[model samples]
Target chain A: MEHILTAFGDILFHPTVLLFLVFGVVVGLIVGALPGLNDTITLAVLIPITFAMDPKYAFMLLVGVYTSACYGGSIPAILLKIPGTASSVVTTLDGYPMTQRGESGKAIGISTTSSVFGGLSSSLVLMFLAPILASYALKFGPPEYFALAILGLSTVAGMSGDNVLKSLIVCVIGLIISTVGMSPQTGYPRYTFGNDYLLEGLPFVPMLIGLFGVTSVFEVAEGLKSRVKDGTFAKMTVPRIGKVLPDLAMVKRLLPTWITSSAIGNLIGVIPGAGMIMAIYMAYDQAIRANKDKKFGTGVPEGIAAPEAANNAVVASSMVPLMSLGVPGNSTSALFLGALMIQGLRPGPSLFQDAPEVAYIIIVGFFVANLIMGPVGILIAKFLSGIIFRIPRETLTAAIALLCVTGAFAVGNSIFNVWIMLIFGILGYVFNKLKLPHSPLILAVILGSMMERGLYQSMVLSKGSLMIFLTRPISLVMLAASVFFAGAPLFSMARNRLKKRAKRGAIS
Target chain B: MKTWKVDIILAAALIVISVVSFSDSRNYPDIASHFPVRLSIVLGILALVLLVKSLIKRREEAMFTLTGEQFRVIVVVVAAVALYTTLLGHLGYLSSSFLLMIGMMTILGFRKKTVMVVTALCTVAVVYAAFNLILGVPLPQDFFMAK
Candidate 1:
C-alpha cells in the first residue's frame, strides 16, 4: 500500500503524465460525442502514436479515453437522440425525451454527476479488487493457468455475437495462427514457410490495427455511401447548457439509483463476456421498477442516471479481469489487453509485483480521471454535444486509412507487416459481413500462446498425465466453470424447448 | 440455401486447414507437435459439427452482394493500399502515402482537384511529422536520399 501510494503520488504530480491524461480525456470526449466514432476507434487509431511513450502514460491516455468516452457518449444521447456508443443506447430513452421537454441542461447535469459517481466508485472497486485477485492468482500452477485459459476461451462463445459456431471457428483459427512461429520447447519453427518475419509469430500490433482500424474505415465508407444515396446525412448543431453541476438535493435523490446501478455494472464488468450492454439494460430495468409512477422512458432524470452511471462504472470494472486474470471481459477490454501487450507489459498475476508503478498508475489514474472528467464534461458538454457534424466524413476516412497503413508499417519497419495488416483487414471485413465478432478471435490470438505454454508445461510437470488438470482443485473448479459457462446457452435452449412443449400440451 | 452455401464452404475450408495443419505438425518434434495436432483435430470435429447443424436447420438468408459502384470503390482501396505497400520501399513513406490517398480520394469522388490535393498532402505531412519528427520512427526516405 505504501509503495502504491508513493507511485501514485509521483505520477499524480508529473506534468507529462497529467498532460497525456487530459489529452486522452479530451479525445475520448470528442470521439464519444461523435455519433458514430467511439473510444475503440480512438484507441485503435492512436496506438501507433502511443508506441513511443512510457507504458504508464500510454495507459493513462487509453484509460482516460476509455472512461471519458462512456461519459462523452451520453452528451449526444441527451442532446441529440443518437447514442454515441451502443452502451449509451438506453440513455437515449429518457435523455432525448428530456431534450424534447426543454430540460436538456438538467439532463446533461444528471448524466455528468451520475457518470462521475459511477466512474469513481468502480475505480475504487478496481483499486482494491484487482490487486487481491492478482495476488491470489500468483499461487496458481501450470494446471491452474491452463484451466484458467480454457475458462477464458470458453467466454469467447459469448463474445461471438449471435453466431456461436462461427465465432468458435474463428477462435480456433486464431489459435492455429498463433502456432506459426517457433515451438516453445524444442526451438523448432512450425509454420514460418521459410519467411523470417514469421519467426516472432504474427506481428501483434499490426494485426490489431488491421483488425480494428482498417475494418472501421471500410464500414465508415459503406455508411457514407448509403447516406449519400438517401440524402439523410444532416449536419448537427452543438447544444448549449446553462449549468451542468447537480445540486446536493438532486444528488441525494439520485444516490440510491446511482449506487444500485454502479454495483450491477461492476458485477457485470467482472463477468467475462456479459458486457456493458447487459449492465446498462439491467440497471435501466431496475430503475424503471424502482419508480413509484414508472416515469422511465418518459424523461425522468433517474432514467438518465441509471444507464449513464452503470456504463461508466463498467469502463473501470471491466478492466478488473484484464488487469488481474489477463483475460478481457469484453471487446473493449480486449482492446486494452492489446494495448498492454503492445506496450510489452505482460498482464496478470505478477503484473503488480513486476511493475508496481504501472499497476498503481492504472488504478490511481482511473480515480483521477473520474475526478477530472466531471468538470471537463461540464465545461465541454454544451460545446461538444453535437460535434458529430463538424468532422468532415471524407477527411476522416482518408486520414484513418493513412493511419491504419502507417501504424501497421511502423511496427518493426516492415512492409510485410503492411501486407499482413491488409490481409487481416480483408478478413475482418469478411468477418463483419458474416456477423462474426472479432473480439473472440483477438482474445484467442492474445491468449493462444499462453494456453499452449500452460498446457505443455502442465503435461511435462505431470509426467504426461492428462488427468493432472482434473486432479488439481483449482484446475478442476475452473474446468467445471468453463463447461458450465460455455454450455449455458445450449442448456437454456433445451430447457426453453421443454417448457414450450409443456405449454403446448396444456393448451391442447 | 444460398447463404448456407457460404457457411458450408467455410466449414469445408476449416476441415482442409485442419488436415494441412495436422500433417504439417507431424514434421515437428513430437514434444511440440502434440498441442497443435490435437487442437487441429478438435477444430476439425467442431467444423464438422457446425456443418451438420447448418444442414439440419436448413434456414437461409441472402448472402452479402455489393453493388458495382461499391465493388469499384473497394477494389480501388485494396489496389491503392497494395500499391502503396509495394512502393513504400522505393517511393518512400510520404510520396507513396500521398499517392495512395490521392488515388483513393479521387476514386471515391472527391471532385475538387485543389481541395483533394491540399487535403491529401496536408494529411500525409501532419502524419509524417508526428511519426517521424516526434515519435522518432524513421519512415522510408527513398525519394529524398540519393540511392
Candidate 2:
C-alpha cells in the first residue's frame, strides 16, 4: 500500500511525466477524432519512439493515449456519420441522428460524460483485479502456462468476424510464423533458413506497426477515390457547437445505463479477444433490452451513452490480462506488451515483485489518464472541430505511411525491419481483402512461442508424458475452458443453421 | 472472381504452404520439429476444410473487389513505399522520406502544389527532428550529412 501510494505520488508529482501524460491525451484525442487513426495504430507508431524515454514516462504517455483514444473515437462518431474507430461503430447508430436533429452538443456531452465514467470505473477494476490475478497466477507451472496459452489462442473464435475457419487458418499461420526463430527448449533455430535475423524471431514492434499503422495507410489510400467522389474533402461542413455538459437530471437518468454498460465492457475487456466491438455491441443490445420506451437508432441518450461508456471501459480493463498473466487481452494491449518488452519490463507477477513502482505507475497512469481524458477529449472536440476536418486526407495518409517506416526503422536501426513492416503491411492489406481477422494472427504471434515453450518444458518435466497437463487441476480447468471457448462459435453456428433449416421447413 | 473462387484459391495456397513448411520442418530434431509439425498438419486440415466448404457452399458474392482508381492508388502506394524503403539505404532517411511523402500526396490526389510541397517538407523535418535529433535514433544520413 505504501509503495503503491508512493508510486502514485511520484507519477502525479513528477512534472515531466505529467506533461507527457497530458501531451499523450491531447495527441490521442486529435488522432482518435481523425477518421483512419485508432488507438492500436497510434500506439504501434508511438511505441518505437518511446524507446528513448524512461519506461515510467513512456507508459504514462501510452496509458494516456490508450485511455483517451477510445473516448476520442466518439467525437467523429457523434459529429459525422463516420466512426473514428471500429469500436465506435455502434455509436453512429444514435450519434449521427442526434447531429441531424440539432442535438449534437447534447450527444457529445453524453458521450463525454459516459466515457469518463466508464474509463474511471474500469480503471478501478483494473487496479484491484490485475494485482490479485497476478499473485494467483504466480503459482502457475509449465502445464498451467501452456494451458493459459491455449486459453489465449482460443480467443480466435471470438475475434473471427464471420468465418471461424478463416480465423483458425490465420491463427495457425501466425503460430507457424512464430516458429521462425529458434526453438525455446533446444537452442536450434527452426525456420530461420540460415538467416541470422530470424534467430531472434520476427521483429515484434515492426510487425505491429506494419499490421496496424501501415495497413491503415493502405486502407486510407484505398478509400481516397471514394472520398473524392463523394466530395468528402471538397465541401466539408462544420456543425454548430453548443452546450458541452450533460444536465444533472440527464446524468442521473443515465447513471444506471452507464454502470450496466461499463460492467459489461469490463467483463468483455478481461476476456482475451472479446474486444471493444463486442463490448459496445453487447452494451447496446443490453440497452435495447432494458429500455422498451426509448426508440433506439433515432438519437437516444441511452444509445450513445451505452456504447461510449462500454468502449472506454474496455480501454483500461483490457490491460488486466496483460498486467496479470502476461497475455494481452486484445490487439491494443498486445501493442502495449510490445512496448513493455521494448522497455525491458516483462509483465506478470515478477514485475510486481521486481519493480513494483513501474507496475503501480502504469496502474495509476490509467486512473489519471481516465480522469483527465474527459476534459482533454472534450476540449479538443469542442475547440478543434474545424481544424480536425481541415487537415487534408492526403497529408494524413502520407504522414502515417512515413511514420510507419520511421517507426519500423527506429526499432532496430535496421532497414530490414522496414522491409518486414512493408511485407506485413501488404499481408495485412491482403488479409483485410480476404476478411481475415488481424487479432488472431497477433495473438498467435505473441502466445505461440509461450505455448511451445510450456509444452516442451512440461514434456521434459514429466518425461514426455502428455498426462501432465491433464493431471494438474488448474491446467485441466484452463484446457477445458479453452476447448469450450474454441468450440463455442462453431457450435453456435451449427445451432443457428439448424434453427434456420427448421424455420424453412415449417414455412414450406 | 466470386468470393468462393477466391476462398478456394486461398485454401489451396494455404495447403501448399503447410506442405512446404511441413517438409522443411521434417529435418529438425523432434523437440524442435514437434510444434510446427503439428501446426502444419492443423493448418493443412483447416485449409482443406475451407476448400471443401467453399466447394460445397459455392457462395457467389463478389469478394472485396477494388475499383480501378482504388486499385491504381493501392498499387502506386505499395510501389512507392517499396521504392521509398529501397531508397532509404542510399538516399538517407530525410531525402527518401520527403520523396515518399510527395509521391504519396500526389497519388492520394492532393492537387495543391504549394501545400503538398510544404506539407511534405514539414513532415520530413518533424520526423527527422523527433527521431534523429531528439530521440537519437540512428536514422540513415545523407552522403553530405555523413561527411
Candidate 3:
C-alpha cells in the first residue's frame, strides 16, 4: 500500500505525466461530446502517439481518456437528445426531457457529479481488488486458465446482439486469424502463407485501428450523402449549463440510488463482455423500480444519475479483469490491454509485482482523472458542445481516413500493416452492415492466443489427456460456469418461446 | 434480396474458408496443428449451424439500396484511402495527405472552398507536428527529400 502510494507521488509529480493527463481529460470531453467520435476511435487513433512517450505517461493519457469519455458522453445526451456514446443511450431517456423542462443545466450537473462519484469509487475498487484478484488468479493452473478462457468466450452469448450464431462464427473467424502466427510451443509456422511477417502474427495495433477507427470512417462515408441531402447535420446550439456540480441536497437525496447503481455497474464491468450498455440498462431498470419520483423518464435526476453513475463505474471496473486476469472484460478493456502490452507491461498477475509502479500509476491516475473530469467538464461544457457539434462530418471523416492510414503505418514503419488494416476495415464495415457483432471477434483475437497457450500447456502436462479440464476442481468449476453461461440464455429463449405459444393457445 | 439470402451466402463463404483452413492446417506439424485443426472443425460446425438457422427462419430484412450520390461518396472515400496508402512513401505524408483530404472533403459535400482548405491544411499540419515533432515519429519522406 505504501509503495503504491509512493508510486502515485512519483507519477502525479511528473510534469509531463500531469500535462498529458490534463490534455487527455480535455480531449476526452471533446471526443465524447461529438457524435461522430467516441472512446474507441479516440483511443485507437491516440495509441500510436503514445508509443513515443514514457510508458507511464502513455498509460496515464489513455486512462485519462477512458475516465473522462464516459462523463463527456452525457453532455450531448442531455442537450441534443443524441447519445454521444452508446452507453449514454440510457441517459437520454431522462436527460432530454430535463432539457425540455429547462433543467438542462441541472441534468448536466447530476451527470457530472454521478460520473465523478462512480469513477472515483470504481477506481478505488480497482486499486484494492486488483491485488486480491491477481493473487487468486495466480493460483490458476493451465487447465483452470483454459476453462477461464472458455468462460470469457462464453460471453459471446451476451454480446452477440440479436444473432448468437453469427457472432460465434465471426469469433471463430478471429480465432482462425489468431492462428496465423507461429505456434508458441513448437515455434512452427501455421498460417503465414509463406510470409515472414506472419511469423510474429498479425500486429495488434493495426488490427485495432482498422476495426474501430477506419471502419467508422467507412460507415460514416456511407451516410454522407444522406446527411448532406437531408440537412440533418448535427447543430451547434449549446444547451443551458450553469452549475459545475450538483446540489448537495440532491446528492444526499440520491445517495442510495447512486450507491446501488455504482455497485451494480462495477459488478457488470467485472464480468467479461457484459458491456457498459448492459450496465446502463440494468441500472436504469433498477432505478425505475426503486425511484420515489414517479415521473421516471419524464426527467427525474435519479433517472440520469443512475445510468451515468453506472456507466462511469463500468469504465474503471472493466479494467479490473484486464489488470488482474489479463482477460479483457470488453472491447474497450481489450484496447487498454493492447496499450499495456505496447508499454512493455504484460497485463497478467506478474504485472502487479513486476511493474508495481506502472500498475499503481494507472490506478492512481484513474482517481486523479475523475477529480479533474468534474471541474474541467463543468468549465468546458458550453465551449465544447457549441464548437464540437459544428465541426462538419466531412472534415472529421476525411481526417479519420488520413489518421487511420498514418497510425497503422506508424507502428513498425511497415506499409504492409496499412494493407492489412485496409482489409480489416472493409471486413469491419461489411460486418457492421450485416448486423454482426465484432466485439466477440475482437475478444477472441486477444483471448485466442491465451486460450491456445493454456490448452497446449495443459495437453503437454496431461500427455494428451482431454480429462485435464474436467479432472481438476478449479478447471471443472470454471468449465461448469462456462456451460451455465452458454446454456442459460438459450434455455431462457426456449422457455420464453414456449410460454408465448401457450399463451396464444389459451387465447385461441 | 432478403437478408437471409445474404446470410446463406456468408455462411457458405465461412464454410469454404474453414475447409481451406482445415486442409492447410493438416499440412502443419502435429505439435503446431493442434489448435487450428480443432478450431477449423468448430468453424465448420458453426457455419453449418448458421446456414441451417437462416434457412429455417428466413426472415426478410429490408434491403437498403444506396442512392447514386451515396454510392459515389463511398467509392470516392475508399479510392482516396487506397490512393493515399499507395502514395504515402512516394509523395510523402503532407503532400499526399493534402490531396487526399481535399479530394475527400469535396466529394463528401464540403462546399466552402476556403473553409475546406483551412480545415484540411490545419488537420495535416497538426497531425504532422504531433506525429513528427512531439512524438519524434517519422512520416514518409517527400520524394525530393528521398532522392
Candidate 4:
C-alpha cells in the first residue's frame, strides 16, 4: 500500500508522465470520436513509437488512451447516430433520441459523469484486486499455466456469439501461425520454409497494425464510393450541443444506476472474451428492468448512463487478467500484453515484485487518467463537434494507410514487416467480409507460444506422463473450467432446442 | 449468393490447408511436431464441422456483397497500396509516400488539387520529422542518398 502510494506520487509529480498521460487522453478522444479509429488501432500504431521511451511512461500513455477512448466513443453515438466504437452502440439507443429532444448536452453530461464513475470505481477494483491475484498466481506451475491458457482459449471460443466453430478454427489458425518460428522445446524450425525472417515468426507489432489499422483503411475504402455517391458526407451537419453538466437532482437519480452498471461492467470485463459489447448490453438490460417507470429507448438519462458507465468500467478491469495471470481478457488488452513484452516486462505474478515501480505506475495511472478524462473529454465533446465532421473521409483514409505502412516499418527497420502488415491487413479485411470474429484469432496468436511452452515444460517435468495435468489440483480445476466453458454454449443450445420441441408438442 | 455457400467454400479451403499443414508437420522431429500436428488436426476437425453444418443447415441470408463502385474503390486502394510498397524500396519513403497519398485521395474522389498536394506534402514532412528526426527511427533512404 505504501509502495503504491509512493508510485502514485511519483507519476503525479513526474512532468513527462503527466504530459504523456494528457496527450494520450486528448489523442484518445479525437481517435475515439472518429468512427473508424479506436483505442486498439491507436495503441497498435503508438506501441512502435514507445520503443523509444521508458516503459513506465509508455504504459501511462496507453492507460490514458484506454481509459478515455471508451468515453470518447459516446460523443458520436449521441450526436451522429453512428457509434465511434462498437461498445457505444448501446449509447445510440437513447442518445440519438435525446438529440431529437434537444438534450444533447445533458446526454453528453450524463455519459461523461457516468463514464468517470465507472472508470474510477473499476480502477479502484483493479488497484486492489490485480496485486492480490498476481501474488496468488505466483504459486502456479507449468501445468497450471498451460491449463490457464486453455481456459482463456475456451472462454473466448465459447462466448464468440453463435459461431463457436468458426471461432475455434480461426484460433487454430492463429496458433499454427504462432508455431512458424523455431520450436521452444526443440531448436528445429516448424514451418519457416527457409526464409531467415520467418525464423523469427511474424512480427507482432506489424501484424497488429495490419489487423487494426490497415484493415480499417480497407473498410473505409469499401464504404468510400457509396458515401460519396449518396452525398452522406455532405448531409452530415454537426448537431447543436446544449449545457454540458447534469444538475444535482439528475445525478442523484442516476446514482444507483451508475453503481449497478459499473459493477456489472467490471465483472464482465474481467472475463476473457466477454468484451465491452456484452458488458454494455447486459448493463442496458439491467437498467431497463430497474427503470420500468422510464421508457428506455426514449432519451432517458438512465439509458445513456448504463452503457457509458459499464463500458468505461470494462476498460479498467479488462487489464486484470493481463496483469495478474499474463492472459489477455480481450483484443485491446492483448495489445497491452504485446506492449509489455516489447518493453521487456513479462506480465504475471512476478511482475509486481520484479518491477513494482512500472507495475504500480500502470495500476495507479488508470486512476489519474479517469480524473483527467472527465473534464477533458467533456470539453472536447463541447468544442470539437463541428471540427470532427469537417475532416473529409478521403483524407482520413489516406492518412491511416500511410500511418499503417510507416508504423509497421518503424518496428524492425525491415521492409519484410511491411509485407506482413499488408498480408494481415488483407486477411483481416476478408475476415470482416466473411463476418468471422477477429478476437479469437488475435487472442490465440498472443497466447499460443505460452501454451506450447508450458505444455512442453510440464511434459518434461512429469516425464511424459499424460496424467500429470489431471494429477495437479490447480491444473485439474483449470482444465475442468475450460471444459465447462467450451461446452456450456453447446449445452444451452441443445436445451433451447429441446424446450422449443416441448412447447410445440404442448401446442399440438 | 447465400452465406451458407460462402461458409461451405471457406470450410473446404480451411480443411485442405489444415490437412496440408498436418502432413507437413509429420516431417518434423517429434518434439517440434507435437503441438503443430495436434493443432492442425483440431483445425481440420473444426473445418469439417463447419462444412457439415453449412451443408445440412442452409440459411437464406445473403452473403456480404459489395456494389460495383465499392468494389472498384477497394480494388484501387489495394492496387495503390501494392504500388506504394513496391515504390518504397525504389523511390524511397518520402517520394513514394507523397505519390501514394496523392493517389489515394484522387482515387477516393478528393478534387481539391491544392489541398490534396499540400496534404500529401505535409504528411511526408511530418512523417519524416517524427520518424526520423524526432524519434530517431530510420525510413527508407532516398534514391539520391543511396547513390
DockQ of each candidate, alpha-carbon based: 0.36, 0.57, 0.51, 0.55
| lDDT against the true structure, each candidate | 0.76, 0.81, 0.78, 0.81
lDDT of candidate 2 over A1-508, digit per residue (tens)? 7866887797788999998899889878865665445678779888999999998889998998888887787886776554556677668768878976867778888999999999988888888887564345445778887887787677567435357888889989999999998888788898888989889899876786677667778887888877988867655455566788998999999999999999988876776665676567667756765775687778999999999999988888888888888888888999999998898889776778878888889888888888788777777777654454457778877887887788788778889898998898889889989888776787678778878888988998999899999999989998997788677767877888999999999999
Chain A TM-scores, per candidate, are 0.58, 0.63, 0.62, 0.62
Extract clashing residue pairs from model 2. none
DockQ: which candidate is best?
Answer: 2
- What residue runs in model 3 are displaced by over 4 Å at the alpha carbon? A1-119, A122-134, A227-366, A377-385, B144-147
| TM-scores of the candidates in the order shown | 0.68, 0.72, 0.72, 0.71
Worst 10 residues of 3 chain A by lDDT: A233-242
Q: Is candidate 3 or candidate 4 better by DockQ?
A: 4
Off by over 4 Å in 4: A1-134, A227-233, A239-370, A377-386, A503-508, B144-147
Clashes counted in candidate 1 amount to: 0
Summarize candidate 4's per-residue lDDT along A399-503 as a digit string, tens digits.
767877887787788888888888988898889888786656766776788799889999999998979899999889879977876777678778888999999
Q: What tens-digit string does per-residue lDDT give for candidate 3 at A203-235?
A: 865776676666767767787678777776544
lDDT of 4 at A226: 77
Candidate 1 lDDT, tens digit per residue, B49-84? 878977887657766767766666666777778888
TM-score of 1: 0.68
Model 2 C-alpha lDDT per residue in residues B1-147, reported as the tens digit of each score: 699999999999999999999999988997899999999999999999999999999999998888888888888898999999999999988889999999999888889999888999998998778667744567998866886
lDDT measured at residue A442 in model 3 versus the true structure, 0 to 100:
66
Q: How far is candidate 3 from the true structure (C-alpha RMSD, Å)?
A: 7.5
